[model samples]
Target: MINAQAANPFGEQSKLLETVAAWTLGLLWVLPLLYAIWTAFHPAEFATRFSLTAPLSLQNFVNAWHAAPFPRYFLNTFLLVTMILAAQIVLSTMAAYAFARYQFRGSNLMFMLVLMQLMVMPDILIVENYNTMNLLSLRDTILAIGLPYFASAFGIFLLRQTFKTVPRELDEAATVEGASALQTLWKVYVPLAKPIYLAFGLVSVSTHWNNFLWPLIVTNSVESRPLTVGLQVFSSTDQGVDWSIITAATLMTSAPLLLAFLLFQRQFVQSFMRAGIR
Candidate 1:
């Protein structure tokens, strides 16, 4: 009984340590975001000075918004993300269908090559991709930013997994009803896999919305600069970086996506859960 009591105390201590560790980690991650929020609204002088006494103002946001063509950047980002997601969805779905449903010879080899892209991303081939973009006459265009993401290996893999999880009995039933493969895919598989589609779409939208490197390399002017690229200008001024203004600009750049995720948090979680199940 004394040994049992000692073991119980050790277990309780371990649980207490785990709880403290979890809270510490959570606070560590949340602190930076909280600091950004603080800097975005605080005066320039108070940006680095952590204080509850700082008076919040909307002036920094207004100044940052007017200093750059943020509206244009936001519009460009929206258009680019939409274009990329739309193209990726269509291409990945078709490719996933082929991989999941068909048994063509050498299919495994082709799929392995496709999956290889997820490891060695297009960004890593920036020079070649940029040259290809130039050759296509899409340089300095949103199309250039959206082009490389047109076929997402990750999306194809996710959708293929989801599609395979769909019961073959549905395909057989539709076949017996004289439905073509396309019809069965559209009516049977696609409908059942809506959650995975949503999950993939969310993943695509979030990723492309924040993409900076390729867009920065390809886009020369404000005409094609996405929000992330645009925010860099405010953060990296030659004269001096205005921390408050830069933070405000960063906040403005991320606000739309942040708001969207906040609003759809439940849906996002549910979709991801379904995708994981598949």
Candidate 2:
């Protein structure tokens, strides 16, 4: 009883410390976003000024929208993400299934090679990818932006792990019912790994949607530029920095992803949980 009573104070102190630390970190993380929000909605003079009675207007957003080819950028980003996701899903599913189900010669070596890709940063391969795009005559196109990412090492690794967890009996049963290899994969394995698929799809969409450097290097025109690249070009100018307009533009470009995360946050969490993704 004495020991329990003595530990209670220490435990309370630890919890209090933890609570303070958490709020401190949370505030730090949110400070920039809060500043952006304030700047985006208020006039240029009031951007740095924190006034409770500051007038909010939508003029910044209007000016930002008219200042760039945001509509074309949006279209390009949408098409890029859609193309990359579809290709990744199909290719990753097939590759993962092959690696998980088949025991062929050098299968382990091949899988190791795939995993090696995860260790190497994509930025490191920029020169080679750019050369390949040039050789293929696909530069300054959406295809060039997505070609290097069509086969995702992370997607394959994730799906392989998910597929390995499925029972062998399901595969056998599908085969016994006169299902071909492709049919078995489609019917039995794919449905069981839906959570992983959802998780991967969301990750892929967000990553490609926000990809800037590669797209910036490959695309030269507004028609081929994604939102990230477009926003970058729009923000940098000979004129002085306009925080209100820049923040408004930043918010506009990121609004889709932010909205998606907010709306599907529960499902996103659940999908990652079910997929055992950390």
Q: Candidate 1 on 111-142: residue-level lDDT in tens?
A: 99989888886667899999999999999999
Candidate 2 residues lying further than 4 Å off, grouped into runs, are 1-11
lDDT of 2 by residue, 1-278 (tens): 58875868789788889999999999999999999999999999998789999999999999999999888989999999999999999999999999999999999999999999999999999999999999999999999999999999999988898888888998889888999999999998999888788778888999999999999999898879899998875567888789999999999988898888888777778877866753
Q: Could you tell me the lDDT of residue 114 within candidate 2?
A: 98
lDDT of 1: 0.87
lDDT of all predictions: 0.87, 0.91
| Cα shift from native, residue 23, model 2 (Å) | 2.2
Candidate 2 lDDT at 247 equals: 95
Model 2 — which ten-residue stretch has the worst lDDT?
269-278
Instruction: Give the worst 10-residue stretch by lDDT in candidate 1.
Output: 1-10
Best by TM-score: 2
